[model samples]
Target: MRVSVVIAAYNAQGYIAEAIESVLGQTVPPDEVIVIDDGSTDGTRSVLERFAGRIVALTQGNSGQAVAVNQGLALARGELIGFCDADDLWTARKQELQLARLERDGELDAVFGKVQQFVSPDVPEQQRARLTPAVEIMPGELKQCMLIRRDALMRIGAFDETLPATFFIAWLGRAKQGGLKTAHVDDIVVRRRLHPGNGGRLHTEAQNLQTLMALRKAIKAQRPPE
Candidate 1:
């Protein structure tokens, strides 16, 4: 199956190249790579230009991740779709392994693998010393770790553009409620870079509230009519 990889970037000049490089270097390269630049004021656009012909680079007004992702989804032309955060790296065998598992099981709508977290090597020694992730590696059910069929994704529908911090969480909740079949592998597929500018770290309060709201919405969707 043709696989399309999507990346949503905003002010990721420092690490976006590495993220794209990792995907390009995968053992089984994606059929297409789509990157949506969310109106970054930094050198992110310049960095994207470096990979001009290799990627389908799109620029848009300062929209949030959800909007950028939705835009990519609309333009994607693949049977299977995957995502990689602008600051994260995919292992060289990520696509190869995940695609194998997906093709082996016709009933599985999606497949995910483990994720390894690490501080960016570019972080200063003092800054790295101050930051520590609770878990180095764990089973990742996040978008970055998933390889899903396009039809399945369409059934779940577009992500909620309103929930900036928790859109994926809300979408995942809805997918589960819709009985999306999924599977997990033991191998590490993604390396999540933890940095000072991480959205979750920078917007803790908003994320917390949004997480609660996503859960409530999921519960309400499952209830009978009043």
Candidate 2:
């Protein structure tokens, strides 16, 4: 099956190229790579232009990641879809392994693997000292670790455009409720980079509130009517 990789970027000029290069260098390269520039006021657009013919680049006005992702999804034409954060890297064999599992299991809607976290190399020693140490490896259900069938994703529906921090969490909750079939592999498919601009770190309070709201919505959806 053909695979399309989508990346949503905002002020990621420092690392976006690495992210795209990783996907381009995958053992099984994606059929297409779509990147949505979410109104970045940096060198990101120029960096994307450097790739030029290699990617389908789209630009929009300061929308959040979910909106950018939705825009990419609308243009994707592959049977299998995968995502890589603008600042993260995918292992070379990520697609090769995930695609094998999906091809073997017709019923599986998505496959995910572990993620390894590391501080970005450009982080200064003093700044890095204040940051949390990297987790060697951890189970990752994040968008970056997923290789999903487009049909199943469509069934789960478009991501919640309102929830900037927990859109994926809310979408995953709905996917589970919809009985989406999924699998996990033991290998690390993504290298999650930690930098000062990391969104999770920047929006902790909002994320926590959104997480609670997503959980409550999931709970309500699963409840039986009287």
Instruction: Give the number of the best model, judged by lDDT.
Output: 1
Query: What local distance difference test score does each model get?
Result: 0.96, 0.94
Cα RMSDs of all predictions? 0.8, 1.1
User: Where does the lowest 10-residue lDDT sum fall in candidate 1?
Assistant: 123-132
lDDT of 2 by residue, 4-61 (tens): 9999999999999999999999988999999999999999999999999999999999
Kindly report the root-mean-square deviation of model 2 from the true structure over all alpha carbons: 1.1
- What's model 1's TM-score? 0.98
Residue-level lDDT for 65 in candidate 2 = 96
* lDDT by residue for model 1 (1-226), tens: 9999999999999999999999999999999999999999999999999998999999999989999999999999999999999999999999999999999999999999999999988888888866678889999999999999999999999999989889999999999999999999889999999989998987899999999999999999999999
In model 2, which range of ten residues has the least summed lDDT? 127-136
Clashing pairs in 2: none
lDDT of 2 at 147: 99
